[model samples]
Target: MTIIFITTFSEVHADLAIIAHPDYQGGELTREMVKELFLEEKLEFPSGHKAIPANHASGSPDRKAFFEYVLEMSETRHKRYWARKVSVGKKGAPKELASHKEVLDWIKNTPLGITYIEKTKVDDSVKVLLTVAVFDDL
Candidate 1:
């Protein structure tokens, strides 16, 4: 008797929506602006509203994708960047929440909170600033 093994693989793609509280009047953000906000380089929106960025917990798929696509930096590089900023008396990283639900809830209550989540998870509570395509292999 002979036996054979079959292997299968799949690719998963998701659109990540960068969302903000409904009260945020900053309007849509360009990719560079979004990156600056998350990196704490730009503290306020063009509308003059404070931009408070929220991040998914470290190691989460959303965090990895956001860092890769939006921020255009690897996690290690981001950490180093923050370390250097902090050493020079600059702001540190954004607030990190444990899950999407926590992030959404936080954004809902915080007037200027901004965060990224899988587009399908978005609801009427927040406004989308930008959508990023995230691809992964299974």
Candidate 2:
């Protein structure tokens, strides 16, 4: 038998794009607005449509980058924040999807859906509200 080695490299940075459904009528979103939306602090878009925020699964690279760049919180802090909110029955965390493809598909069919994805995955299927450059190894 021969021995083989496998090497894995972590990403140095990932460019993420905050995207919404193509039909979403809201204007460009500020980081504050995106934070509020994702945290469930604000429930509606500027257009008065109900906002439905989606997230990548916990521990995902995109999720980690989003928390660092956009939300300005560490994963532990985010979990604590949401845990408190949920414990108090105030609100729950955003919908968690598995992959970029799933998020894209969901957002495309949902008028007020919003989520983040790798910048390279962005296309006409969704409208980008913000593009963040995340520099991290998480």
Candidate 3:
């Protein structure tokens, strides 16, 4: 399971308090990845949509560019799949984590992988298993 820290804002460098775990709970992220899965595809864009997340201060310009790339990919997928216009990008309001401790708190609380219980035993035995796979949200 992937726990994502997500937030929204109307402007860059402005502060918002809540950061959600599943920002695009329904296949939004997955669709973006699939379309941009190819390295060349990452540069792809659609017609009439040119606005990228803007950075007025030029602080971490690359970060803004990356966000724009992902947002563009997501928007393209959204239009292609649902036949709707997904907003190109939203000003990521300045987001401030409630506290540095909150990150640690979330990490401490989240379970490693996920647990499934199989019941068929005379007594009972606990077994730990390892598995690897890409989890697709879409």
CA lDDT of every candidate: 0.88, 0.87, 0.26
Query: Per-residue lDDT tens digits of candidate 3, residues 16-51?
Result: 111112211212223243224222233222322221
What TM-score should be assigned to candidate 2? Answer: 0.85
The true-structure Cα RMSD of candidate 1 reads 3.2
Ranking, lDDT, top scorer first: 1, 2, 3
Off by over 4 Å in 3: 1-28, 31-58, 73-138
- Indicate whether candidate 2 or candidate 3 has the larger TM-score: 2
- Give the better candidate number (2 or 3) by lDDT: 2
lDDT, residue 72, model 1: 92
Tens-digit per-residue lDDT, 1-117, candidate 2: 999997666665659999999877987788889989998888988778889999999888899889988888998998899999989878778889998889899999988899999
Model 3 scores what on Cα lDDT? 0.26
Instruction: Count clashing residue pairs per candidate.
Output: 0, 0, 3
> What is candidate 1's TM-score against the reference?
0.87
Off by over 4 Å in 1: 1-12
How far out, in Å, is residue 80 in model 3?
23
